[model samples]
Target: MMELAHGNEVYTWPGEAFPLGASVKQNGVNFSLYSKDATRVTLHLFASADAASPQHSFELNPSIHKRGHYWFIFVGNIGHGQVYGFQVDGPWLPEKGLRFDKDKVLIDPYSQAICFGRNYSRERAIGPGRNMDASMKSIVVDQSDFDWQDVMAPRHSLNDTVIYEMHVGGFTKHPSSGVDKGKRGTFAGIIDKIPYLKEMGVTAVELMPVQQFDVNDAPQGRQNYWGYSPINFFAVHAGYSVENDPLAAINEFKTLVRELHRADIEVILDVVFNHTAEGDENGPTFCFKGLQNGAYYITDKETGNYANYSGCGNTCNANHSVLRRMIIDALHFWVTEMHVDGFRFDLASVLARDSNGHPMKEPPLLWTIDTDPILCSTKIIAEAWDAAGLYQVGSFIGDRWNEWNGKYRDDIRAFWRGDSGTVSRFASRVLGSPDI
Candidate 1:
């Protein structure tokens, strides 16, 4: 038997921060979060994903749970599939660049599975008041539960790569897709179409943003079809899962990857690390904004407003030490846990900027990612430009990074459109743009 502190029948213990997310240990679940300036942090536990209120709440004592920049707690009798969220308290002065609202429940930045309800409303999260019933919750999932059945990554070299970039939902959502109504537009649907991909001689499928994104993040009358507005970097999109259960997305996603690997096909996720579904100043409060706004985002030096280098109303502070570690940790999770082959960064140029929004000659985030031991063998690709017109085509620092070759597309289009005497430029593009 293990000793545990019980207050009103809520058992708790101190947790470490080596693993940042909520981890299911042998005895209980360890919850950890990074908040630099937070004075107090509270953990809320719910009976279900869509519970209207918390079943139990524990406010972590700073002396016991606080260590450095991380706040953590180990709750006894809580294991896998437990639904939880955090409420952080601090100064709410937005003009000073601090937007901490203790009432807004926040998803864990390191969550492996996210639980969203049909009635989930981002609008209710923007201002004060508790929004537990209307907000998204994080589910504690065991990362080691899946059985790979001796499957491994294809790990095809970049020189021999034949990438077929496509969207996950659009691949089979249409009636012309000829898939079963229930399996259409799901990870299982992709498994149903693997034969066609094999016949086409494609080596890898560049999945366009499988990370959990906001479907309602569009104009009032439209939907976000491309999935550029991501909400959680760690969880697979719940919309692509079959059953409404919390574990369905995680297991089905792993099944898709394992099945693809069996056919000698590689999986590359197109990740958007620049901006999130949470947009500018008027945007809703999610995980990062509520936990630590000044650390997660790039703000104006004088007015403290968001610096929109990503053209998405706000830019992520990718080079910050904390965010950089989170990026690397997310990459390791996909590569080691999910067995993903590579990553194609959307608006990757924004990652090269300094905290002040200026481009860096040697961005620490890029250098760290390039040199990280776990990611050294993984393929890293970049779009090579940002919405702010900061382009780094041939000048991108990392030697291991492959670019999308935007110039080649432009030259090819110009030559085909008969714009001018562009034979030399077109030929160079045909020759892989060595002139670049």
Candidate 2:
């Protein structure tokens, strides 16, 4: 086993590379990251969330620590709540689509929880230079620590489901929400409003993107109010948690899900697997772009420019082998661990595109999610369209996947407005859009 000393403490172990994230074990915490083209990988350990510098940094020797494209290490002393990040060294050739900045501290792609330090600066990550102090760090979490209370999801059928779409923060952030002072705009606040939802006869709550997203990913002087621009899929957004503790969001979100299930209300996450917060080539490198830019995102072969199918700057290469696996793993984690009832994929048609950005007849990622045993019983809803106008409402792949009928919404609105030739279309829409 490899050994590293930090002050008087010595940490040692050769970590496993199977589980892609930081996993807590009896020995210590095992960290594994994937970088197909990276030459060197350095792991940085921080003393605290806002620490100006790393307490210790280890440069993994590829001969020993690397197994294929994965770099892994097990620290003997550290377990839960450990803050860490990575710095990968490789070719910085944007023309060839390889953006690897050794100076920037990149979070784990499979981070269960993230720590945004006081010095965290999205601007600093945009340009060059070291972003260790200014970058967000990933925290090690013991997933087994929480007691789910054996609460199960009340999976309501689509025919009987009355879904209420709401944003977690905006639902109770205002004073008029009547939520407790400290608990307002948090997962705990959602629990307090459960009784109101039950009264409304709402069977399910389709929450806007609750995954950890980049709030700074908006225009200049503006913030990303909506939680659509996600950073990490596995971690819950920390802003919606009551405490600043790194692990608070995880446990609190679990509690919210458990409580909602107890009230016989299902939780459906509006997931954004189409794109990431890391925008185009000029955007910041948080995780995916820094690790393997070419693999994570679909880019132009000649110019190396990102495919803007997501209309949010860059489109995720969901059909790629690595990304397909990561997406499936994320879904599995939410269903098995978080106990969520369903997922509403935002711009899901983007997942239908091939590696070259053309629509595929049968995308591998969608099929995997459809056939996965863990997600077989879980509800799956697709937006059935992308920003680039690849509409597949009636033709969306997967027999089990239900699509959001955009035609029904449009025709119903037109009929209500008393538009021309609306009577015939309106009749079909009210009858469940049989004409569609």
Top TM-score model: 2
By summed lDDT, the worst window of 10 consecutive residues in model 1 runs over 1-10
For residues 1-436, could you state the per-residue lDDT of candidate 1 as single tens digits?
1236565354788778768889889878899999988988989999887788999888888888889988998888888899999989898767666888888899998988888766688788887688989889999998787899998788888778888898888898987888898888889889999999999988899999988877778888788888898887898888887774557988999999999999999999999999988898889888988888878889876677899988988999999888888888899999998989889999899999988889999999888878888887778899999999999888888878888999998999999999888899999999988887
User: RMSD of each candidate?
Assistant: 2.3, 1.6
Candidates' TM-scores? 0.95, 0.97
Error of 1 at 373 (Å): 1.9
Query: Which segments of model 2 are wrong by more than 4 Å?
Result: 4-8, 417-421
Compared with the true structure, what per-residue lDDT tens digits does model 2 show for residues 230-342?
A: 99799999988999455888889999999999999999999999999999988998999889988889999888889999999999999999999999999999998899999
Candidate 1 residue pairs in clash (backbone atoms < 3 Å): none
Question: Model 1 lDDT vs. the true structure?
Answer: 0.87
